[model samples]
Target chain A: MIVAAAKPWEEIMASLHGMHKVLVVGCGGCVAVCLAGGEKEAGIMASTLRMQRKLQGEPVETEEITLTRQCDPEYVRELGKKLEGVDGILSLACGVGVQVIAEHYPNIWVAPALNTKFAGATLEHGSWEERCGLCGDCVLGQTGGICPIIRCAKSLLNGPCGGSQDGKCEVKPNECAWNLIYERMGRLGRLNQLLEVAEAKDWSQGRDGGPRRVVREDVKLDD
Target chain B: MSNRDFAPKIVAFCCYYCAYSAADLAGSLRLQYPPTVRLIEQPCSGKIDIRLLLQAFEAGADGVYVAGCLEGDCHFLQGNIRAKKRVNAAKKILDKIGVGGERLEMFNLSGSMGPRFAAIATEMTERILRLGPSPLSTADKGEEGKAE
Candidate 1:
């Protein structure tokens, strides 16, 4: 799931400069599971803002709401009338939610309450490890279940990079994804897959293409 | 409140398996620790997230600490280790926010270490006393948040 971290109270305060009233929107999607921007988190953010503003002698009134998924237009659109008088809107969703809300409500001043971290998993409670780089062209089939694109320090495809020592990545204590791949392949008698000489990844599918979109014509409505 | 009048509110999140038992033992032995230290029990210290830690500070806690099972003895296998990393991460944020990263801490101890629990309580209380009150608390009561 996409993980996120809350912005500092000071930075949040700075964004609300003249806004005396605001709405804090939360997403019940990936961020909610990651414990970043959920209904509970939204409430906490509103409370923190009030506390900080009170400290600065500029207490602001805040309203809170958590949508099923802020990325969808329906949930956010349902909140139209609620934003009527809010001086601003603070989105506790991932970057996507903030952008979606901003795009839908061009006139409303919107600020992000959380920093979207990465496409990762909760290693343990409170510990999230990045697993996928979202490189568009997935190579999980050829490289065991692990994606070397993000797990490998350098995202090496052919073999373990020199930085990998005793199965650990030089960047962190994590095991080299390639080494883990090799070991898993060895056990599965699929070691031959490693010798397939992979081709250079197509860069067009990645961030180089700028904003990406997938049009599912099969599911689209006839407008 | 002024530094002279600040007593410093410290909150401790203790793992039920270890730190909680240690606290129980401390009381059993009648160990004398600072009264400023407040203990909140958690199933595992791993449950303490950055938000929870920040909330404590936001709610007037001058200092906050997480006490978990010693290193490799976590009841949930790796909960304490995860808690340690979270504490470290939160500390960096504390440092960046000018809260004096020293205000947040993480400690590891077994259920048998009653003296250690007492020691930690005293140590955290002293550290917080020196740091005075949290900037938010000070600002709410005094002139401005000072931001430190």
Candidate 2:
């Protein structure tokens, strides 16, 4: 899931300085699952903004709404009816969700309330770590299911690089991904497979090429 | 309002297993305490969240405090501990928004501590009195130096 964190209060306030009425939108997608830009967080942000403004003697108004998934056009469309009298929008979704709303409403001012972090998973309650680099390639079949592209500090395909010490990554406090892969492969009696040197990864499949998109004629609906 | 005439509104969230019972005991004993505090009973101090604490201030509370069971004596094992962390989080937020974190606090005491309960009420009232009304409260009265 995509994990995100709320931006500083001062930053958010500064962006909406001239707005009298604002609509705070929450996404019920990856951000909701990670506990960042969910409905409850959106409500809290709106309340905090109003209270801060009231204290400042300006007294701004704020309304809260949570979309099923802000990344989807159908849910983003739901925001159209609520935009009446709203001078600004504070989207509590990930970057993708924010862009979708901005793309839909070209006239309304849109601001993001979160800093999209990474494709990650919750390691524990209130703790998240990046798990996928989104390199646009899969190598888990050869690496014992451990994603070296993200888990390893360096995206080394064949590794246990010199920085690996005592099964820990010297660059981080985490257990070295290469070490874990080595152990798992050994247990599977597939250690012999590691003898082959891997070729360089294809950079074109990733962001190295411009923005990427997918098209599936089978799933497309006639306009 | 003048300092002497100002009556700060203090909200106290009391856990039923401890602080609430202590307040009840204080009432039965006819102990004297400030009238500034308004009590709201909760199933456990753990039920308290950052939103509730902030809402109290947003509703014009001059000061707010959470009274939970003594450390290691919570009825639900860790409710008081959780409440303590939340209080700290809310305090940081209050400070950030210029509301003064000193306006909010958390205390731990057993259900048998009636005198202690009265002491806390007196302490919180005095502290709030020294701090004066919250910026939100002052803003409501349309006073100057609102919340710069």
Candidate 3:
């Protein structure tokens, strides 16, 4: 899932200056679970903006809406009827969801409220750490379950570089990904798999190459 | 007469099973506490959203306090825990927006703490008196120097 954080307030204020009727749209997928741009966050942002606008004497009208998944066109289509009279949309979804909104509603101005960070998971409450790079490869079979592509500073495939110290990554004080994988594999009596090296990741599937697409003819919209 | 004219408006959200019972106990005991504290009974502390807390401030509450069950003794198991998180988050937001986070508080007490509830009400009312009035109220007073 894509991880993101809200943009700074100054930038948000700048984007919403002339807009009177604004819709703050929230995505209920990854961003919601991570507590970055969920329904609750959307409500908070809308309330804050309304208060700030009132203080500025502009008195903007703000409405909040949350979708099941913003990345899907089917979910976004439900917003068409509610888009009437809305000057613009402030999307709390990831970059993909924002672009999908823009592509779907070309007439309305859509702005992103979150800066998409990475594919990650919540380490604990209010704390999230990057886990996978989606580098078009899966090397977890040989390296236990940890992905060095994101956890390691250098994205090393063979083993930890000279940067590991005391079973921790030298770049950070956190536990070394390789060390964790090695220990897990050792415990499982699969230490011999460590001898096998992972190949270089193919870069085509990630965001850099182009927009990725998946098609399912059986689940067509008309059907 | 001027000294006796001050009346601080307080909003108390009492969770069921504990704090609500405590308030009931206070009433049953005929405890002499200020009537300024308006009780808003809720089914569980978890149901008290952050918006309601902010709304209390917006509605001219001099102080707001959430009374919930003891930390691990929530009737819904973790309702008080969720309420505590929201209270902490609301406090941070209040502080950042120059609202003085001291105006908001969260207290945990069992159903038997009628005296404790009375003490909290008195303590909160006194604290707000020392702080004088909310900055929002001061803004209404047209005092520019003390607006913050």
Candidate 4:
């Protein structure tokens, strides 16, 4: 899942300076699980914005709505009926969610409330680390299920790079990703897979050149 | 009422498992505490989101305190930890908006601490009294009534 954090309040306030009625939309998927721009976060942002507007003597009316999944067109379309009177929308989802909302309702102006970071998982309560680079390849089978593409500072393919020292990445003081993969494979009795050489990652399926899309005729709207 | 005669309205969010039971014990014991504090029982400290805490202040609460189970002893394992993070975050926002971070606090206690609960009630009331009435409360009393 994608990891994101809310942008600074000052920047958000600046974007909606003259807006009177605004709808703060929250996504209940990955962002919700990560505690970023979920329902609770959207409510907080709405209240804070209302308070800030009141302090400035500007009468701003803010409402909140949390969708099941903002990235899906079906979920975003559910907001069409509620968008009747709202002047604008403040999306508290990832970049994909924000774009989907904009694409679905072109008439309503949409703004993102979070800075989409990367695809990752929580290490603990308040900490998260990047886990996948989405390089259009999966080398976890060779690297022992741990992703060195993201965890390693240098995306080493076969084994630890020269920068690795004492089972730690020299670039940072953190434990080497390859070392974790090696240990995991050793435990699983799959250490022999690490001996095979790997090739450079193909960048076509990733977001390097342009956007990517997926379509299925069986699940088409008309069908 | 004049500024000097202001009565600070405080909202105390007590978790059901600990603080709420402690309040109940205090009542049964006839413990003397400030009437200025209004208690709202919540399922767990984690359920008390930051928005609710700020909403209490926005609804004209001079001070807000979240009473939760002690650290490492939350009934839900880590609910108290989440509550602490929310309180700290709300405090930062309050400070940023000139409301003074001291207006919001998080207290930890067990279900049997009736005396401790009363002490916190008195302490929060006195602290708010010293801080005077919240600016929002002075500007608009009817607004808070609408929220309720």
Off by over 4 Å in 4: A188-192, B16-32, B43-46, B69-81, B109-116, B139-148
Model 2 over residues A1-223: C-alpha lDDT tens digits? 9999999989999999989999999999999998889887887788788888887878888889999999999999999999999999999999999999999999999999999999998889889999888988788888988999999998899878999999999998999999999999999999998888889988777887788998999999998
Model 1 C-alpha lDDT per residue in residues A1-223, reported as the tens digit of each score: 9999988777877887899999999999999999899987887677667665765567688888899999999999977978878999999999999999999999989999888989999889779989999998999999988899998888888989888899999998989999999999999999999999988988689987679999999999899
Worst 10 residues of 2 chain A by lDDT: A202-211
Clashing pairs in 4: none
Q: Poorest 10 consecutive residues of model 3 chain A by lDDT?
A: A50-59
Model 2: docking quality category: medium
Which one wins by DockQ: 1 or 2?
A: 2
Residue range B1-148, candidate 1, lDDT tens digits? 5667778789999999999999999999999998898999999999988778877887789999999999989999998989998789778766655565799999999999999999999999888888888877766656443443
Label model 3 with its docking quality class: incorrect
Which window of 10 residues has the lowest lDDT sum in candidate 1 chain B? B139-148
Residue A108 accuracy (lDDT) in model 3: 95
lDDT against the true structure, per candidate, is 0.87, 0.92, 0.84, 0.88
- At residue A92, give the lDDT of candidate 4: 97
State candidate 2's DockQ. Answer: 0.49
lDDT of 4: 0.88
Share of the reference A-B contacts seen in candidate 1: 0.19
lDDT of 4 by residue, B1-148 (tens): 5646877788999999999999999999999999989999999998888889999988889999999999988999999999999899999887766677899999999999999999999999989888888766654654555568
Give TM-scores for every candidate, taking all chains together and pairing residue i with residue i: 0.67, 0.94, 0.84, 0.87
Fnat per model, in the order given? 0.19, 0.37, 0.04, 0.37
- List RMSD in Å for every model shown: 6.1, 2.3, 4.2, 3.5
Ranking by lDDT, best first?
Answer: 2, 4, 1, 3
